[model samples]
Every structure is written in structure tokens, then in C-alpha cells.
Target: MKKTILIVEDEDILREIVKDYLLNGGYEVLEAADGNEALSLFEEHEVHLVILDIMLPEVDGWSVCRRIRKSSNVPIIMLTARSDEDDTLLGFELGADDYVTKPYSPQILLARVKRLIESRYSTKHRKAAEDALASCGIDVHFPSRTVRLDGEMIRLTHTEFEILTYLMQNPGIIITREQLIMKVWGYEFTGDDRTVNSHIRNLRHKLGMKANLIVTVIRSGYKFEAKR
Candidate 1:
């Protein structure tokens, strides 16, 4: 079956360009010229992924992403004209799976789409295994990227949840910060440890005092410890 991708972009030329590439790549393409239309299409279709533009006529991408996150965990790749780091971070916070700057190569964008789709499926399979092991108390659905604690839902950013899941899977063993950067972010050369710290702070805050479940390894890094 062809995977469906919804492109919520206002640029008619750019939208058609992307739609064509996706169609050639064997994906079903759905295009929306505004946020309202995007939402309508979303509600009416089983979209496998979304490529959302930050600027729109009615609601803008951030607002659109916020509304979408309220009901769905569908993979989103945000498109931005600016190269601002803060914008990318905000998109990540709003559950975007990836971000692409404007004037990007169509081939590169297509590659990114293929990569994210594969990752989504692979993560789904891994989560099934993790769910079996984490069956009762805390359920972490990797593909859908939702977490449930004691049957109550918790909101977490992509990196935060990814880091938490990695630690949980390797409980009792000391996993270094570098290892975490590579594992959680899928890349190690971003040249900022602050990203890791920021995610940890947010994760701990979300987990509350049970933050103790993640232990700092003094000089080495950190590890996950199940509370007794």
C-alpha cells in the first residue's frame, strides 16, 4: 500500500513540486493551501505523515501542529524559511519529527521523507517489544510517541522520550552522555551537551520527584534505575 503524506504548504509551486516527488516515490500525496484546509484533510484522511509549513494564511504551522497534537501523533516534518534554532526547537516541542529549511533540495527532502517513514515503522516494532516488557506501569509507545504512566497520559518531546526509553532499556548500566547523544539524537556531533541537559531537565520535571529513577553517574554520564 502507498503511504499517504499530507503537505500543508501555501506555496502552490512548492507544494506541487513536493507532491510530484512524493508521487514519484510511490506515496499518496495530499496538498493543503491553508491551515483550515489542512485540518479538514487531516480529519478526513488516514494520513501517514505531514509536511507542515510555518507560515499560512489562516492559522500558521505552530497553531496547526498544536491542534494536531491534541488528537494525533502522526509524524510531522516542519518547513521553515528561517534558519533559527529556536524555531526548530519549538517545532520539536510541538511533536515535529523533523524540520527542513526552505530552499532545500527536493531530493534531500525526499530522502528525509523516506528516512522518517522507515524510522517510524522501525520504532513501532521496537515499541511493541518494549511494551511487552514495560507492560504494566508505564507504557511507552515509540512509533506513536506517547507515554502513559499508571494509565494516565504524559506529554514528552521527541528527544526527551527517546532518551528516557533508551535509559529504561539499558537499566542498571552506566550509559555515557556521548552514547546518549548518539543514541537519542541519532547523531553525536551537534556540538552541544546543553541539548541533552535541557531534555533531561524537562524529562525530570515531567516525571516529577520520581526523577530519581534517572541517576547521574557523577563524572561518566547517567543511567536508569528502577525504584524499589
Candidate 2:
């Protein structure tokens, strides 16, 4: 089935441009002029991804994204004219999967949309397989996508689970950011290294100090170091 994308931009021209580009790319596209309308449409449709502009009439994209994260893990890519680092970090903190600056190439945006859709679906498949793996205390089970601490179950997002699984599967072997991005994100992430760091922070936040199962390998990468 073709993935559905919701484009939320108050500018009529940009909205139509994105819609047309996505439609040409073989995706089902939905458009909303503001955050309120976008949220309503989001609630009504089975959208696979969201392209949200930061500035909106009813509500801003950041708030919209926070609200959405409250309920779903659907991939969101924020659009903004401001290139402020703080804004970008804030977006990531709110669970946006990616970001694109304004005056952006439509083709680049379309490519990002395609990648997000593909990654989300691919991760779903990986999760199903990972859900069956065996994980001992503070251990990761790659094939089953399971995490266990002291023989208890732990919940992780698809991205976090994938990253941990990769690390554990290669136990004691350090993997670079590029490799981790390819494995967990399903694409060559050209963005800052902080993307990986931010996700790791999130994984740690969820796993707590028990997450020492994953060790930062200083300037090289991360590894799943089983405690002796």
C-alpha cells in the first residue's frame, strides 16, 4: 500500500508543491494549512509520516509534534526557515525523526519522506523478529528486539531497540556513527553526529544506569559490553 503523508504548511504554494511532489513520488498526500487542521486530519487519517512547518496559524509545529508524540511514534520532519541550533535540538528532543530548512529543495524533502516511510516499515519488521529474542539481565536480544534488566522486561522505541540490538549483536566491537545510522535509521544520515547521541541519550534515559550495558567507546563508537 502507498504510504500516506500529511503536509502541514500555512503557505498555500509550498503546501501544494509538497503535495504534488509526494503524489508524483507515488505517495498518498494530505494537506493542511495550519496545525489545528493538521492535527484534525492526522487524527482522521492513517498517515505514515508528517511534514510540519514550524510556524502555523492555530498552533506551532513544535506543539503539534509534542501532542502527537504523546500518542504515537509516527515519523515527523519539521520545516523551518530558522537555522538556529537550539530550534533543531528542541525539535529532536520532541521526537521529530528529521528536519528540513526552508527554501529547501522539493526533491530533497521528497527523498527524506520516502526514507522515513521506508525506515518506519522496515523497523516494524525488525521489531517483530526482535520481539522473540532472549535477553538476560541488562542484556539485549537482537533477533527478538527485547531488552531485559535483572530478568525484567524493558520498553524501548524502535530506534533505540535497533541501536542496542546492533551493539549487542556485535558485542565488544565498536561501530561508527555512519554504520549505526545505516543500521538503525535505514539510510545514510548526513546530519550531525548528535542525532545518534540524542537517541543514545533517550535510550539511556529509558534504561537508566542499568543501561551501562551499552558503553560509549570514546571518539570511536559505542559497544554492548557485558559486565564481567
Candidate 3:
């Protein structure tokens, strides 16, 4: 079955262009001119991915992204005219899977959409290799995608979970920001090192006392050290 992609943009021309390209790329496309309509379509359809514009009528894209993230981990790629690094970081912080600045090539957008969808679906059937990783009073369970520190369950976002899992999987080894981006967000990801730093910061805060397990290595990256 062809995967469905939701395109939410207030700009009619841009929305049509994206819809055309995605349809050409063999995806079933749904179009929404505003955030409210986008959310309505999202709730009604089995959308596999979303291409959302930050500025929209009624509700904004950030609100839409946050609303969707509250329940579904559906892949979202944000489209914004803003070139500011802060905007990009904010989009990621809001649980967006990717971001594309305005004047972006439709082909590149389609490629990112395809990559994210593929990555999301490919992992859906993966069985847990090692069910759990326990160290320093923190336990991470792969099957349930849950984490516990000192026997208290900790809530982590999808990105945070992946970052922690990757670090825990390679204890004592220095994992660079670039490596984390590639592994956690996939090789197609184009964000800078700040993205990794942001997630690491959030992960550490959530880890609390166990946060020290993720040690920063000066200019390099970070290492997860299990308590001896």
C-alpha cells in the first residue's frame, strides 16, 4: 500500500508544489491549508508522515506538532521560512523528525520524507536484541522503550531515548555529536552538532544523579560510563 503523507501549509502554491512532488514520488498525499484543518485530517487519516509549515492559520505548526506528538510518534518534517538556528533547534525540541528551510528543493524534501518514513517503518518490526541495559541504578528496556532510575520510571522523548540507548550501548567509548546524529536521526539528517547537544542536555537533566553517567569529553563528544 502507498504510504500517506500530510502536507500542511498556508501557502497554496507551495502546498500544491509539495503535493505534486510527493504524488509523483508515489505517495498518497493529503493537503491542509491551515493548522486546524491539518489536525482534523491527521485525526481522520492514517498519515504516515507530515510536512508542516511553521506559520499557519488558526493553529500554528508548532502547536500541531506538539499535539500530534502528545499521542503519536508520527514522523514530522517542518517547513519554515526562518533560517535562524534557534528556529531549527526549536523545531527539533518540539519533536519534529526533520526541518527544511524555505526555497528547499522539492526533490530534497521528498528524499527526506522517504528516508524518515523508511527508517520509521523499518524499525517497527525489529525485535529487541538485548531486552535491558542496567547500570548505575538506571535501567533501559528496549522492548518497552522505557527507562528507570533508582526504580522510578523516567519519561523520555523519542530522541532522548535513542540517544541514551546509543550511549548505553557503547559504554566507555567516546561517541561524537556527528556520530550520534547519524545513528539516532539517520544519516540523511542535516542538522548541526547543537541538535545532539540539546538532546544530551535534556537526557542528563532527566537522568538526575545518574546524569553523570554521560560524561562530556571536552571538544570531542560524550561517553557513557557505567558505575563500577
Candidate 4:
């Protein structure tokens, strides 16, 4: 079955270009000129992934991302013209799976879409594992993808959940940022180490007192300490 992708961009030419590339890449493509329409289409369609632009009419991409995230973990790759680090960070913070700066290769964008869709479907079986990790009042249920700290349910984004899962799956072993990116975000991700750091920071903050479980190994990477 061909995966469906929603392309939300205000620019007509760019949207058509992306749609063309995605079509050529064997995807079912949907187009929206603004965030409002994007949200409408997202709600109405069974979209496998989203390619969203930051600047839009009626509603901005950030709001759209947030709205979609409230109900779905569908992969979202943000498109932005801004080169600022803050912009990229904000996108991740809003639960975006990835981001691409403007003037990007359409082929690269299509690759990202393919990777994200594949990753999403590939992990569906993970929720059926029925295995779990529990220690020091922090409990993670792999099947349910739920976390609890001292009996209190903790909310975590998809990225955060994956990072915590990978860390706990290999306790006491130092996992490099590169490894985390490859395992959690897939190989096509072009973001740097700071991207992993940002997600780790958010994950740790949510873990609160249990945050120490994720230990930073200077000059190397991070480790999930089984005890400390």
C-alpha cells in the first residue's frame, strides 16, 4: 500500500514541486496552502506523515504541530526558511520528528518522508512486546509505551519515549549521541548532536528526581544508570 503524505506549504510552486517529487517517489500526496487547511486535511485523512512549512496563513505550523500532537504521533517534518537554532529547537520541542531548512533538496525531503513512514510502521509491533523495565520507582511498560514515576503517570513525547526505551534497554552502557540518533531518529536524520541533547534534556526534565537515571558521559555520550 502506498503511504499517504500531507504537504503543507503556502508557496504554490514549492508545494507543487514537493508533491511532484513525492508522487514520483510512489507516495499518495495531499496538499494544503495554509495551516488551517492542513489541520482540516489531517483530521479528515489517514495521513502517514506530514511535511509542514513554518510560515502559513490563518495558523502557523507550530500551532498545527501542537494540535496534531495532542491526538496523534504521526511523523511530522517541519520546513522552515529560518536558519536560527532557536527555531529548530522550538520545532523539536513541539514534537516534530524532524526539520528541514529552506532551499533543501526535494529528493532529501522525499527520503526523510520515506524514512519516517517506514520507522512509524516498523515500530507498531513494539507496542505489542509485553516486556517492561522497572527500577527505583521508574517503570516503563514497553507494550503500552507508558512511564510511571513512583506510581504517577508521566507524559512523554514519542521521541522522549523512544530515547528512554533505548537507554533502559541498555543500562550501564554508554550510548553515543550518534547511536541514539541512528536508533531513535533513523539514519536519514541530518540533525547534529544538540538535537539528541535537546530531546534528552526534555526527557530528563520530565523524569524529575528520576532524571539522574540518564547520566551524561563527558566527551562521549549518555548512559542510563541502573543504580546511583
Candidate 5:
């Protein structure tokens, strides 16, 4: 089945340009002039991925992302004209899978769309095959896509969930930032270390008492080691 991509941009030219690219790439394209329309379409369709602009009319991208995350783990790539690190971190904190700045290449944007869609579906397959991490009191329920610490449910954004799962899958082994980016983002990461660090920080904050399982290796990367 051809994946569906929702494009939420107030700019007419940019929206159509991305739509043209995604359509040419053999994916179904949905256009939303504002966040309200984006949310309506998302609720009505089985959208595979979303390319959402940070600026919109009637509503904004951040609200749209937060609302969608309440019920689904869909991949969301945030678009913004600003290059501020805080905005980027905020996007990740809200469960965005990727972030792209404006004045970017349409081809590169298309590539990111494809990669996120592919990663989401492929992970579904893997999750179905084998699931759950019951070690160290923190558990991941893959089928329902939920995590719990000692019986209390923990809410995590899609990216944070994936990152924690990857670390838990290889306890005691250091996973470089490059490796985490590849495994979760499903591509060679050209972004700086700050990107991964921001996600990890959010993940640890969410994990609370169980956060100690994730250890940052000095000058290396991160590892998950449960101390019994």
C-alpha cells in the first residue's frame, strides 16, 4: 500500500512543492492549510507519516503534535524556519521523530519522509516478532506500545520510546550516538550530537527513578546497565 503523508504548511508554494515530491515518490499526499485541517484529516485517514510546519493558522504545529501523540505513535517531522536549538528540543520533547529547517531541499525532505515511514513500519514488524523488556523493573510492552515502571505506566514520546528500547535491547553495551541515530531515525545522521542528547535528556526525565539504567559514556556514547 502506498503510504500517506500529511503536509501542514501555511505557505502555499512550499506545501504544493512537498506534495508534488511525495506524489512523485509514489505516496499519497494530503494537504492542510492549517493545524485544524491537519488534525481533521489525520483522524479520518490512516496517515503513515506527517510533515508538519511549526507555523500555521487557527492552530499551531506544536498543539497538533501534542494532540496526536495522546493516542498514536505516528511519525511526525517538524518543519520550521528557525534554527534555534530550543525550538528543536521542544519538538523532540513533544514526540517528534525528526526536525527540518526551511530553505531546505525538497529532495532531502522527501528522503526524510521515506526514511521515517520505512522505519515506523519496519519496527512494527520487529515488534510483532519479539517484544517486551522485563529487566530492571522497567518494562516495554511492544504490542500495546506502552511502558511501565514497577506497575505504573510511563508516558513517552515515540522517539524516546524507541531510544529507550534500543538501549534496553543491548544492556551493558555502549551505543554510540551515531548508532542510536541510525537505529531510531533509520538513516545516516547529519545532525549534531545535541540532537541525540536532547532526546536522551527527555527520556531520562520521563523515566524518573528508573533513569539510572541509561549511562552516558564519557567521550563515547550511551549504554544501558542495570545494577542489581
Candidate 6:
């Protein structure tokens, strides 16, 4: 799919020039003569990036940038005729990804657009791959009290979950059954090691092929070990 760039410039010739360069670069271009049109177009389409001019009628570029930042993290490059430092600073504070002064080469602007879009997409894809790998082995989310094994969700009872969470937290250290009951069921409980044994059996069953991650010590109890 082609990436879309919204060009919000009030100047007719500049807009046409930038749009031509972007189009030739194999990107889909959207033209907005002013800030109001820019906002409207942004709301209507899937705009991957924005090229905004600071001077406009109805609304200024800064206001447009502020409004876009409230909803989207889409890359934005602000264009201005003035090379004022304050304007550049304000654009950055408003979340503009890049800034270009007037008379910039159309080819240079296109290069900036390509870099910003590539950067945003690369970061998104990297994060996605990391998230997927997070579930590849035994993955636990403590806040949600959920566990995933080999990319599949495993349902566990409250006690079973607590037992698994504990072993996982202390991987490579064998935990005695008495210690497990004391921690999971609390010190006040009177249950024996059989109680811990029952929960472990069911937890291992739910874990399927990954059950070897929980290794049993001969005279002691069990510990979690990551697959080599």
C-alpha cells in the first residue's frame, strides 16, 4: 500500500511542486490550501505524515499541529518562510518531527518525508516483533495475573497461578513444597506438601510441552528453568 502525505500549504506553486515530488517518489499526496482544510482531510483519510505551513487562513500551522498531536503520532514537518529560532522551538514543542525553511529543494523535502515515514514504520514493526517474541516462551504479566506459554494463553486457577508465578520469579532455585504453601496459601494454612503437588500436576498439564520448564529436585521440590 502506498503511504499518504498531507501537504497543508497555502502557496499554490509551492504546494504543486512538493506534491509533484512526493507523487514521483511513489507516495500518495493530499493537498490542503489552509489549516481548516488540512484538519478536515486528516480526519477523513489515513494520513501517514503531514507537511504543514506556519502561515495560513482560518487556523495557523501551530494550532493545526497541536490539534493533530492530541489524537495522532503521525510524523509532521513544519514549513515556514521565516528562519526564526522561536518558531522552530515552538514547532518542536508542539511535536513537529522536522522543520524546513522556504526555498528548500523539493528533492530535499522528499528525502525528509521518506526518512520520517521509514523511521516511524521501523519502530512500530520492531516493537511488534518484540511483543510477539515475549509470548514465545513462558510469558507472565503480573499486573494482569496472566501467563502465556509458547504463544498460547493458559488458563490457571488462582492458587495455580500464584504457584507458577512464584517459581518463575525464582528460576534456577529449587523451592521446597513447604515454602510454596507458606508463600501462596500463607503461613497460617495447615495443608501438607500434597496440596502443592496437586496444583503442580494441574499447572504442568496446562503448560503442555513446556512443562519441562518446571524441574523437580529428587529430595526437594520444584524450580523453573528456561528451555535451552
TM-score of each: 0.79, 0.83, 0.82, 0.85, 0.88, 0.56
lDDT, model 6: 0.77
* Model 6 poorest ten-residue lDDT run: 127-136
Off by over 4 Å in 5: 123-129
Residue pairs clashing in model 6 are none
How does candidate 3 fare on TM-score?
0.82
* Worst lDDT 10-window in candidate 1: 185-194
lDDT of 2 by residue, 31-82 (tens): 9998899999999999889999999988999999999888777788899999
Total clashes in model 4, counting residue pairs 3 or more apart in sequence or in different chains: 0
> What digit string (tens of lDDT, one per residue) describes model 4 on residues 107-196?
888877877767556555533444678877889886556789999988776678888888888889999888888888776666677788
**Pairs with backbone N, CA or C atoms under 3 Å apart (clashes), candidate 5:** none
Arrange candidates, best TM-score first.
5, 4, 2, 3, 1, 6
Residue 215 in model 5: lDDT: 98
What's each prediction's clash count?
Answer: 0, 7, 0, 0, 0, 0
Which residue runs of candidate 4 sit more than 4 Å off their true CA positions? 123-155, 188-190
Which candidate model has the greater TM-score, 1 or 5? 5
lDDT for each residue of candidate 3 in 17-67, tens digit (9 for 90 to 100): 999999999999999999999999999999989999999989999999999
Model 6 stretches with alpha carbons more than 4 Å out: 123-228
* Inter-residue clash pairs, candidate 1: none
lDDT of 6 at 62: 98
Instruction: List per-prediction Cα lDDT, in the order shown.
Output: 0.79, 0.79, 0.85, 0.86, 0.87, 0.77
Across 188-228, the per-residue lDDT of candidate 6 in tens digits comes to 43334544566677678888888888888988989988666
Question: How much does candidate 6 score in TM-score?
Answer: 0.56
